[model samples]
Target chain A: MEHLDYSNQAAWTRVSGDKQSPVALSDSLAVKNDFETTLSFNYDHTASYVRDTGAGIEVGLHGTANIGNRPFSLNQFHIHTPSEHTVNDKSYEAEIHFVHEASDGRLAVVAVLVQSGAASQTYDAVLAHMNQKETFDIPVDDIMPENKAYYHYIGSLTTPPLTENVEWYVLKQPVTLSTEQINHLKTFYSHNNRDLQALNDRPIISSN
Target chain B: MEHLDYSNQAAWTRVSGDKQSPVALSDSLAVKNDFETTLSFNYDHTASYVRDTGAGIEVGLHGTANIGNRPFSLNQFHIHTPSEHTVNDKSYEAEIHFVHEASDGRLAVVAVLVQSGAASQTYDAVLAHMNQKETFDIPVDDIMPENKAYYHYIGSLTTPPLTENVEWYVLKQPVTLSTEQINHLKTFYSHNNRDLQALNDRPIISSN
Candidate 1:
């Protein structure tokens, strides 16, 4: 077994781009661009989370995904407190990111917004194993909303090395978890989200 | 939500005892003390391994066991390459530590010595997730040898703080792993063992 740095080296090319992430998502501004090839998720296997980075918790994934006929492999997912990208200027309690990568180095990040309400068993499992820093079954598909409709755009990662050319999908429907669950996660991270960036005249595609 | 050292604080109590671990086990000099309540393992969950400790891979366990009717919950297990204790003055390839704790904070370390031979699927799973540092199902019982008989004694932990008063149970049977698997583990850690401790007048009890 080879000793690894445990990070995607390709994301650290040191290039800044105009299209940054966490932009305010407005339904009125987003253009409906529902094409024949829609986004599809083929999630399976339990994911393991790592606390190696100062960015907080990041869970490694081993699932496949397809966006507009382009194939990508899900690599990892992480969370942002108080949400990052707003839905029609309305911020939620939290946001979860499912990051994927293609063989050619293409990246796709499917994000889900979370609100306070009923308890999510999926969130419950993640919360139990979060501090252990060991891989427990993550149930990647359950973390998403049933609607599956989303807002799409091109943006760079909010974290350092700030890689660009990544595909961003912010789901339309928000999933609810018990307030205690959201609060428990916040205990590990709070206000860790990147500040809202400018849209820069970029068109937001709605996958309605 | 507080940051933790992730190690047992009780094991760090600084008191070097005459009865330390990794002592050479000699059957000819051992005494047979068969008790009514034998060692029993109740394992089910998949354990996740963490790579945080420089001492190499540490897998967190959620299983319970009984050593002579004294109940203990297993907290973690770790691998030491090139073996630690010698059986009949003959050394093996590796040694594994299943660190357990009783309600009263009494420590019990169950060890299994490994030799070079056939491949072990149990070891294969551990090798797969050792670097990932996430909790995967550990199947704790499989990690043990079929023979329940072991050599019992008193000792201190082999690592730092080296707290004494630990109940040591080094199984008599030596489990086997492929030469390649042992080498693969050696790639991560090699010759990382505490120096052989003296017998120091402690009687080794053989569960024959």
Candidate 2:
């Protein structure tokens, strides 16, 4: 990974490659309701990575998903403040990315948006353990929205090496968090989000 | 210095800080003809730095300049394909940055835009030595334009740490290079330039 200052100009070049990218997510996506599955996570404080921009708390997960006949097991998960992917061009306060990988090394990421609102028990539990630097088990379902609708597309990693051709599934509905919880997260990561890349004429399929 | 990939999106974030920034260059700068001085450089092949996006050939220089009573000595110089700074919103194909520093650590950068047209003997010499990885000496005057008109502003380095409050002198007149020469440089650094940064409501002094 390149030493990248998320807050610098070196992070604002064009997205290249012949592949399609960052297609907008609206209600026009083709719905696929097969994403339903149970995922388990263990909060490992030491697994967190820190940069000048923000902190990425890695969560260990145990589960798998089958997208388009390709099975991807949950590899790891991390958090990004102010979100990376946008929904209809609107960004959220935070985002949770569950990175999964297939036996052949293909990747599929599930993104859950977080917005400021009522306090979330899941977030509270995670933050409490995070503050203590202790380990705890969490049911991924506890952090997901009741609605399972998502927008699917092909995009690249937000960080360096920016490997392309990853399958993306961004939830349409956002989970809620208290303003205080949001502020607490910000205390760890002030600004750690990448600017939006161009769509490059890609299509975003909505799980209607 | 942070590991930076100029060809990626990590190179495109807003320049932020409490310090002043590079403003636009219009026809309003107070021209000081005192920039006239002799600068000598030896193109030591082993003095080059390479990255994924491009290569920076370090040129040793000897000279000094005074902008507003602050004296800055010529430090080193590098090249960027596709100009980084824009002149009144206009950008060129490429740019050369001559970085200068004061005893107190303050910086001043002199930028010379590169365009495709007539063949330039200076560029040809530099390119020849660069291709052969040999050492050669160049007179700074040979690469400068007849018109010393420039745009002055305060901006940060397009790369990382993005230290602010650097004095900038962008020559309004551009130097020419042959199309083949431009293409050759591009072959090494096709997309190694940072996107134009915002003026941040700062004033751009046009050196009339």
Candidate 2 lDDT by residue in tens digits, A1-208: 2433333544544323423233456564343433333322332333232223223555554566654434567766767787877776687899988788644344678888999998877666566566343446554555677776677766766665455546687877898788998888777665566667666545555555
Q: Which candidate is the best by DockQ?
A: 2
Off by over 4 Å in 2: A1-23, A28-55, A131-134, B1-9, B12-208
lDDT of 2 at A129: 61
- How good is chain A of candidate 1, measured by TM-score? 0.86
Segments in model 1 whose C-alpha atoms lie over 4 Å from true places: A1-208, B1-16
Model 2: residue B43 alpha-carbon error in angstroms: 62
Among the candidates, what TM-score does chain A have in each? 0.86, 0.73
Per residue, candidate 2 scores C-alpha lDDT tens digits across B74-145 of 766777777776665676788888888644344778888998898767666566555343346554565667
Strongest candidate by TM-score? 1
Worst 10 residues of 2 chain A by lDDT: A45-54
The number of clashing residue pairs in each candidate reads: 11, 18
How does each model score on lDDT?
Answer: 0.72, 0.60
B105-169: candidate 1 lDDT, tens digit per residue: 45789998888887888777777775676767655555688888888877767765455556788
On lDDT, the leading prediction is: 1
